[model samples]
Target: MNSFTQYIQQLFANEVGGLFAAEPAPLREARQKSMDFFLAHGLPTRKMENWRQCPIDGLVQSDYRMQREADPYRPVEEYFQCQVRNLATQMFPFLNGWFVHPDAPLTKSANGVITGSVAAAVKQCPELILPYLTTTHADKADRGLVALNEALFNDGLFIYIPANVKVEEPLQLVSMINTDDNLLINNHNVIVLGENASLSFVHCDDSIKYGKTLINNVTEVHLAPNAVMHYYKTENKDADSLLVNHLFVRQQENSEWVSNVVTFNAGYIHNAIHLDLDEPFAHANLYGLYLVDKSQVVDNQVFVAHNAPDCSSYQMYKGIADDSARANFNGHIVVRQDSQRTQAYQTNRNMALTDEAVVTTHPFLEIYADDVKCSHGATVGQLNEDAMFYLRSRGIGERTARMLLMYAFANEVTDKVTIDSLRERLANMVERRLSGELTLCDQCRLHTSDGKVLIFDVDPDKI
Candidate 1:
């Protein structure tokens, strides 16, 4: 066995029982199965088709501790602050790999929505949590990194919405990695919505410590018939951080699902998403945006499966890279033989700001049904020189003209966000990021370089 695989097995053998005693029996069994799978398959290498472009040799070779406790020197609340102005939200914080209750009491709504730590919910509502804990979208084949997550994840958020309920405000979950020690973190979350229910969820990832660390996170979402859900994810970690995030969704008849992934900074980051349209008339929309520079790498992999007739799916992703950065996008759509009258479309566009920047895109469609309509396209190029000259001719400065064009390119994905405040916040942040005025540690006070917090005014017209 490889050293990495042996190290993971030893870690699990040493602490699996003591660390996860609160989990239900079914969950424990799942963990054991996952451990076995990981040991057998080990980690993926360059030979694998899906992981060829993205390399993880350095990440796997490093020695990282499994953090189970928060750092005693720093308070967790020092890292939990709102980035969006005037946006009232129920917040839950996950530090390292464990859930930490916020300073303010978490809102308990009268609409029968339960939100708290996943381990606590497993003990309180085993019937509801056990059925879907690790059962939905179970893959029987080789899934190296996912199996590792199932075996090692300690705690994350759990949100349950009852039938016929609509949440008025957005629910936010902030996950932070702050420690002086080198660490590897594993976290898992579950979100379920009942029939005719609707909810908006925002997930954010940040870091305060400058040390190198690896974060592995997994989230599963289920929507009942006639339900609607909107999900938004933002990543703004330090340049030394490594991240792997997985998101899975299952939709019933007449349900609607929309998700957006916005990435600002990271050293090596990979995002994998899977959507299953299980019943008739279900629809899904997937969108993503990433900005990277200075040797940073970002990869986005998406899969959509049409299992029922009359279902639809759409995907759009845009990225910008400069100074030897790399960006990768791979989107796959499959229509089963029994599924008829399916509609799907995908598009990927990227801009390279420097000669050393690299961007790769692959959009694939596999159809076993005759009565399906699907299309996909991808483009990679620099900013339009003609348009730049046109704006320059009008007396606009070169730097301002370039920033304006880049902002216009990224605004296409930002404009699709339904939350008005969040959309405005993203627009402002993107403008600052493109102009090289934004710092990587803007949200955390401990890492601010100048000792004074920097804030930007939101301009709705810019978007």
Candidate 2:
């Protein structure tokens, strides 16, 4: 067994009971079950099909503390803040996997919405969130990493929207890491949108101190009939950070889920999403954009299950990898035998700016149903020579032209962002990232220069 696995076993036996001894019975039972599962499966290996291309060697080698005392000297806001301009959101702050706020840990809005820390919800309003808190989601299957998160998670964020209500402002979650020592952090988030409700949410992940840390995070979302949800995620960190994230989403009749994930920087990042369309006319639109340079690495794995007729799912992922960086995308769509009239499409495209940079894409479809329209495709190549030449001939510099093309390619996904202010902010960030301006920390140990904003105009007809 891996030393980390053995450590987990001993940790569970020694502290699992004590961790939740004060919590209610259901919470204890749920965590115990997850601990038991992890003991049996251990950490997922590269031999596993879903993990074959991703390596976890660096993750397990460290003897990180499972929990740590809250850092009194670390000022998180001094290190990182919301970069989205003019995006009005009810912001919640998380420092080192625990939600830190001056107000009550759990609060109810005037509009009958519950938003705050997940751990506080369990302690304060158990009856309100009990049904979904510790229960198994039908659309989700177990994974060793996700089990690890469930077994060890202490605090995160929770957002609940009651039936038939529309939230005016988006809710923003900032998951920030700034530590003086190497540590392990596990947290879970729960989002529940009731029938006929609609809301927009944004999640940001950033690192400030550049200390080595392993973040194992999980999120579960439940959408009732006719609900509409817009979700966005951003990750930017130094090279010393390792992140593993899992999301389980379920949609009911006539519901819609629109999600955009953009990764600007990270040392090692893995994002896995499991989506289930449980009723007819449900639709999911998933998009992602990533930029990696140096020796950085990123992996996005998505699975969409169509369980009802007339359900539709779409996925588009694009990334740029430079230097010796690596980017991987794996998307799988499954249409059940009973799910007739299912429509699913997936596309992955990447730009390998250098010969040493590697990008791998796998778009798969499994259709057990007879009446289904499904297609999957991937492209791995460099910048379009014709477009580059066109720009150069029009008196544009090579570097600026290159950024323009890359920006144009990325706009396809970011343009789909529903929130207006947030969309504009993302566009600016993308430009800065392509120009080498964006960094989570003021100065990354592996990085030297910061980025500046530059405008590149391209005539659509000429290009």
Best candidate, lDDT-wise? 1
**What ranges in model 2 sit over 4 Å off?**
68-80, 136-142, 441-463
TM-score of 2: 0.91
lDDT measured at residue 126 in model 2 versus the true structure, 0 to 100: 88
lDDT of each residue in 281-388, candidate 2, tens digit only: 999999999899999989999999999999999999999999999899999999999999999999999999999998999888888999999988899999999999
> In order, what is each prediction's RMSD in angstroms?
2.7, 4.5
Candidate 1 versus the native: TM-score? 0.93
lDDT of 1 by residue, 1-463 (tens): 8787888988898776577765677888888888888788777666666676776655665478988654443344443467586777777777777777634223346879988877777777788777866662336343577888888887778899999998878998888776787788888888999999999999998777777888878899999998999999988878888888888899999999999898988778889898999999999999999999998899999999999999999999999999999999999999999889999999999998899999999999999999998999999999999999999999999999999999999989989999998887887888888888765737533433444444434454652
Q: Clashing residue pairs in candidate 2, if any? A: 437-451
Task: Give the worst 10-residue stretch by lDDT in candidate 1.
Answer: 444-453
lDDT of 1: 0.82
Badly placed stretches (over 4 Å) of model 1 are: 70-79, 102-108, 136-142, 444-463
Error of 1 at 282 (Å): 0.8
